[model samples]
Target: MTAAVFGHDGPWTEEEYLALGETQQRVELFDGSLHVTPAPTPRHQRISRKLGNVLEAAAEAVRLELLEAVNVRLRPGRVPIPDLVITEQVDLDELIIEADAVRLVCEIISPSNAATDKVLKMHYYAAAGIEWYLLVEQETLTMHLYQRQGAHYVERSVTKAGAALELTEPVRATIRPEELLG
Candidate 1:
């Protein structure tokens, strides 16, 4: 069973952390523990920002919205601040806080979260019914797209800079990995 997050306006219910707001740390709550991550290196930010920019441009062209650095509150007591998260926030005005409304969640992995992104968090997002989860590695400029199936996720594509990502459900648009990695 999942526990409700106790105390404060931040993210988690089991514990407390203000490093993301106090310092430059890009932290998250993984299974109720405070995972303090280092400030994103230039390469990390480059990839994240590039991807956000690309999605933002596409959203504008399509008259939708793509968000970045949004703290998502998943029910299993996990609150992750993803690098480039895409949810249509135009008419919604604010995050629903407790639903599977987010269309996609993308993470540009740092050294600390390579396995966490690919393995652990996969179950978290999949269980929450998030439609898609994408993983990006800045060092090699690779993209891994996972779409949720019945109860698990099947890897849709493991792409490189030359490949294009196709968004199928909420929108059908193709974006080159190079444009997202910069």
Candidate 2:
């Protein structure tokens, strides 16, 4: 499938923006503009859900929270719904209503969103000061992990079916591609 194209324009408020969501293409309000991309296919969802479950189960003991496709506010009104998020257990009061940022952010890559997930979104996560960022490539069925190094991120490990990706504090379990992409 081809990528979804959107017209470039000034940023809009959260209330005024998501209400104008387009039916022609999938779009995200990034920094205020409509960052568009084609819809993810079934295979993409399978991989994403698979990994989310693994991460969630592994984090149960530590009380680390697993957020799935939840909108997060970075600045006053800036928001983006990451595919997966790992964070500390905090009050639900400000969630979904405030600009709450998490410590770790992760995304599953689809063919139509390869660039957005790998590049644009990566930069966005860093700019938000997230500690760890993860990229899961469904095409290759592997996980690429990164950790912030003084405001920048260093690619820590790339794990395949035979191996596992190590997680951060609170969630000490490792994730395997077989458990994620199978």
Candidate 3:
């Protein structure tokens, strides 16, 4: 979740959180507590879209699919939405993408919630056994590709703007960071 889960009464169950349907705000559960935030900025949306487009072709060529802003259920109580996700094809009707079914989970950093993207969510993704986690820093136009090594993510590459990122795990894709900032 983007915001802290304190100053409230108690933690809310997953079912309780979902029942408060579609508030148009971004909502996630961290430590069984509800955290909500406003929608992303225009720059964030643009970057996410451009990055997804670059990854989409590679995903399609490999018979995988690219999904944007989809709920990824890491486990029973935690469901976080990443800006982009690449996964093996599954039925379209599935509500939340299971952690195992996901090959790669990507998050585009928002300035207001950078830690949640870089550290907090990264730990959760690694703990869920997610194989790949791609973190994009919008401010610097840098992408850090992390591969799951044993129980944690090991930094595989750090590509800067105008540089190309070559990925061999989770999927094969060459991404140019500059294209995402445009």
Compare the candidates by lDDT and give the number of the best one: 3
lDDT of 3 by residue, 32-72 (tens): 87667789988888889898887898889899989987778
The clash numbers for all candidates, in the given order, read: 2, 1, 0
Q: Which stretches of candidate 3 lie over 4 Å from their true place?
A: 1-9
Question: Rank by TM-score, descending?
Answer: 3, 2, 1
| Per-model TM-score versus the true fold | 0.78, 0.80, 0.91
Model 2: worst 10 consecutive residues (lDDT sum): 1-10
Q: State, as a TM-score between 0 and 1, how close model 1 is to the true structure.
A: 0.78
Q: Which lDDT values do the candidates have, in the order given?
A: 0.69, 0.71, 0.84
The reply for model 1, stretches above 4 Å from the true place, is 1-23, 61-63, 90-99
Ordered by lDDT, highest first, the candidates read 3, 2, 1
Residue 97 C-alpha lDDT in model 1: 36
Off by over 4 Å in 2: 1-10, 18-26, 91-101, 168-170
What TM-score does structure 3 among the candidates reach?
Answer: 0.91
**Candidate with better lDDT, 1 vs 2:** 2
User: Whose TM-score is higher: candidate 1's or candidate 3's?
Assistant: 3
Candidate 2: pairs in clash: 11-32
